[model samples]
Target: MIQPTKDEIRGWLSEARNELRSERFRRRLLEHELCSAKRALGNAVLKGQINVPIEKLGELVLKLQKESETEEADM
Candidate 1:
């Protein structure tokens, strides 16, 4: 039988923990990712790679957050 290395075992455990995550915890993570994503998008727009107005960005975030909350309610 093949044995997994210590690093591989640790990675598996980390993935398993994520799979068992609570909705509240997931929502918190979503919020963190949302912030980072917005920052990245802003940088991309500044670099001229994407074109998005400030008002549009705000609206998009609001729509995404509302959808996320609805999904969490079902979870």
Candidate 2:
């Protein structure tokens, strides 16, 4: 397995900061480019990512812009 060096991760973060600020990520709710960090978070918190079990978290998704760009079959 290839794990990123600390400096590589830091470099990615710096680039991510620019992309997130300049690109559609902050505005678009459903889609963004995926990285290991994102994949890991999604896997760890998959349940709470959508149709969340907890009330407040569900409320948070509802309160924010929530839409499905792809069908369940795709994921």
Candidate 3:
């Protein structure tokens, strides 16, 4: 799977929140993607493939956390 940019992820999160009208739903989606990415990174690391940058990982994690907060507030 292709890695997504932080801006692309943020846009997707925003769109999901707006379209679903449920922050919880958006959070779930974000969580699933994050888990998938982590697994992919793990596999890549084991195989000596180029993994994602640390900075991008941090950004994605922060964004997921912020989105989770939004979900909590809406609930």
Candidate 4:
């Protein structure tokens, strides 16, 4: 196996960090979008535009909020 030089290792680490930062940024954007979509759905339900049960929608929103929190914590 060929051994990597210190500079090579540093470069790899830098790349990894950049990639991770990019991924986190993307996730945050997506999370915001998810929240927006949830709000829109909730509004639609409230306005009688959707036929979903209120309790079911609340539960689904709660579940999604918890999942989003968990993901944020993980990051």
Off by over 4 Å in 4: 65-75
lDDT of 4 by residue, 8-44 (tens): 9999999999999999899889979977997898799
lDDT of 1 by residue, 5-68 (tens): 9999999999888777876698789889988997998799889899888899789879988997
Better-scoring candidate (lDDT), 1 or 3: 1
What TM-score fits each model?
0.40, 0.29, 0.40, 0.75
- Residue clash pairs of candidate 1: none
Which 10-residue window of candidate 2 scores lowest in summed lDDT? 64-73
lDDT score, candidate 4, position 65:
79
Mark the 10 consecutive residues where model 1 has the least summed lDDT.
18-27
Best by TM-score: 4
lDDT of 2 by residue, 1-75 (tens): 999999999999999999887676554443444345556665667755544457865674564434343333456
List pairs with backbone clashes in candidate 2.
Answer: none
RMSD of 2: 15.9
RMSD of each predicted structure: 9.2, 15.9, 16.6, 2.3
Order the numbered candidates by TM-score, best leading.
Answer: 4, 1, 3, 2
In candidate 4, position 62 carries an lDDT of 93
Cα lDDT, model 1, residue 71:
75
Steric clashes per prediction = 0, 0, 0, 0
Whole-model lDDT values for every prediction: 0.87, 0.62, 0.83, 0.90
Report how far residue 51 has shifted in candidate 1, in Å.
2.5
Global lDDT of model 2? 0.62
Q: Could you say which candidate leads in lDDT?
A: 4
